[model samples]
Each structure stands twice: as structure tokens, then as C-alpha cells.
Target: MVLYAPLLFLLVLVGVQFALWALAQLGVQYAANHALQTTRVSGGTAAAGRADAAAVLDQVAGQVVVDPRVSVTRNPDTATVAVAGRVPAVVPFLRLQVTTEVSAPTERFRALTLSLTSPSPAGEGDPR
Candidate 1:
């Protein structure tokens, strides 16, 4: 029984470490998904799309316990949006960074230039 105690403790410790790593990955995925959603709603406009993506990233950063650093890039011509973010590990005495990227299709419109429309008030309703 005495010999088994140390082994059990070690297994528990390793399991906790793995859980932290999984959490970090989940955080990265969350940030990526948020950014992609923002880009889709913002449309193909350069400035507005970037701003929307940034806002989404900010929201995720606020909720995540890890370091918050997000980058958003949009190609209006190609109608593609890319979002990237890094999540820090939660375990003590360990330094791990998990980066994730997500790409989304841009909005479709007949006109080359997107029309400037006022954004609806936050939490009012669905933007779509």
C-alpha cells in the first residue's frame, strides 16, 4: 500500500497536467471561432471587417485565463478571413503556447464596394 501511494499521486499529477494542456487548446479554438464569426458578420469591407474581428478577439481574450494576443487578417478581394491567437499553458513551472488559426468565407454582394450600414446595438439581437 505504501509503494502504491506514490504511484497514484504521480498519476494524478500527470492527469492534471494533461487537463491543463487540453484547456489551453480549447481556449485557442474558442478564440479562433470567435474571430471567424466576427469576420463573417463584418462583411468584405477592409476596415469594418478588421474592427469586427478585433472585437471578437477581444471578447475571447477577456474570457480566457491565458495571455491574450490576437491577430486578424482579411482579404476583401478573395473574400477570406483569417484569425490567429496564442493561449498560454495553465500549469505551474511550465511554459507552453498553443496557437490556432481559423479562416472563414467573406460575405457575398453584387456591388464591389460594401455599403456602410450602422451596426445594431450590442446584445439587442442577432447581427445576421
Candidate 2:
């Protein structure tokens, strides 16, 4: 039993590490998506996107993600957000990093003008 015990333990550790990495990846993706959504809306800014990404990371991957970094970029046509972080090492000397990026088209709002003045009767306005 002793010969097989170490192998079993190592397998279990690897599985756990993989699970943690997966969780971190999911969290990072979620953060990026949220940030992208925030920045893609009308009047949204890069700062707002970064803040939203940070908030989501804190809520979703606070424990698993180490040294989390968030970046947001906005242009006239598109908005993008990227989230990156290292996962806490579960096994000895095993380190993993997770990253995700999301982007969407920026919303554009057009101003509409309404004229309140009532038009005169079509036939009465002209002398026939």
C-alpha cells in the first residue's frame, strides 16, 4: 500500500490544482466580460470599465487570484477589457496564471430634435 499511496496523493493534488486553475480562469473571464459591458455602453469610460473589473475580481476570485491586474481600453467604435492573475499554487512548485479578454461595440446615441410649433393649414397658407 505504501508504494501506491504516494502516487494516489500526487494525483489528488494535481486534480485540485487543475480545479483551482479552472476556477481562476472562469473568474477572470467573468470580470473581463463585465468590464467590457460597462465600457461598451454610451457615456462609458475606460476608468469605469477598470473599476467594474476590479469589483468583479474581488467578489469572484479574491482568494484564488494573486496579483490581479485589470486593463480597459475604449475607442469611438469599440471597448475592450482584459483581466489577468496568477492562481494560488496548490502543489509544490506549481504555479499557474489565468487571463481573459472581452470586447464589444461602443454604443452611440443620436440627438433627436422635435419642433413644437403647429403648422398652418396647407390650403390657407397659399393664395390660389
Q: TM-score winner among the candidates?
A: 2
| Candidate 2 residue 85 C-alpha distance from true site, Å | 0.4
lDDT (10s digit) by residue, model 2, range 1-128 = 99999999999999999999999999999999988999999999999999999999999988989999998999999998989999998799998989988888999988999999998888877687
Off by over 4 Å in 2: 111-128
TM-score of each: 0.55, 0.84
lDDT of 2 at 16: 96
Best by lDDT, which number? Answer: 2
lDDT of 1 by residue, 55-81 (tens): 655654443435555566666633344
Score each candidate by Cα lDDT. 0.58, 0.92
